[model samples]
Target: MPKLTKRTIDATEPQVVEFFIWDESIPGFGVRVMPSGRKSFVVQYRAGRRPRRMSLGPSTVLTCDQARTRC
Candidate 1:
């Protein structure tokens, strides 16, 4: 996806299955949208050869800028 922005995030509608939108500017930084319509900021990185995933926080609690900074 494009850069992580309020507009882009807001414009994304959830589907029956959960989906992810990764930030183009920040590698591994992204947002996850659940089928329930809940949104949260997330970061995915490799811990050595193993991949790790962590949730920054809910989008309702953190802005895109804040999440990007945390990433």
Candidate 2:
């Protein structure tokens, strides 16, 4: 995984954005911003031959450390 770049994404009070990391030539990991401005970490791994979407949960509800543990 690559380093995440911190930057402002939206003008709203709850800003939403995304940070990506390349793993083994694939964008296999990233963090997504929710409408509430919460940051949730995500990992895109293949389930057999198909891709899957997994939620790490809301930022306030789950800390980055917690989300990482989920991943």
For every candidate, C-alpha RMSD to the true structure in Å: 0.7, 5.4
Model 2: worst 10 consecutive residues (lDDT sum): 4-13
lDDT of 1 at 45: 98
Best by TM-score: 1
Alpha-carbon local distance difference test for all models: 0.93, 0.53
Residue-level lDDT for 6 in candidate 2: 36
Residue-wise lDDT of candidate 1 within 1-71, one digit each (tens)?
78989898888899999999999888999999999999999999999999999999999999999998898
Q: Candidate 2 clashing pairs?
A: none
Show model 1 residue runs off by greater than 4 Å: none
* Residue-by-residue lDDT tens digits, candidate 2, 1-71: 44432332122244444443332333555566555555655777889999987776754476545656677
The clash number for model 1 is 0
Q: Candidate 1: worst 10 consecutive residues by lDDT?
A: 1-10
Off by over 4 Å in 2: 1-27, 34-38
Error of 1 at 4 (Å): 0.9
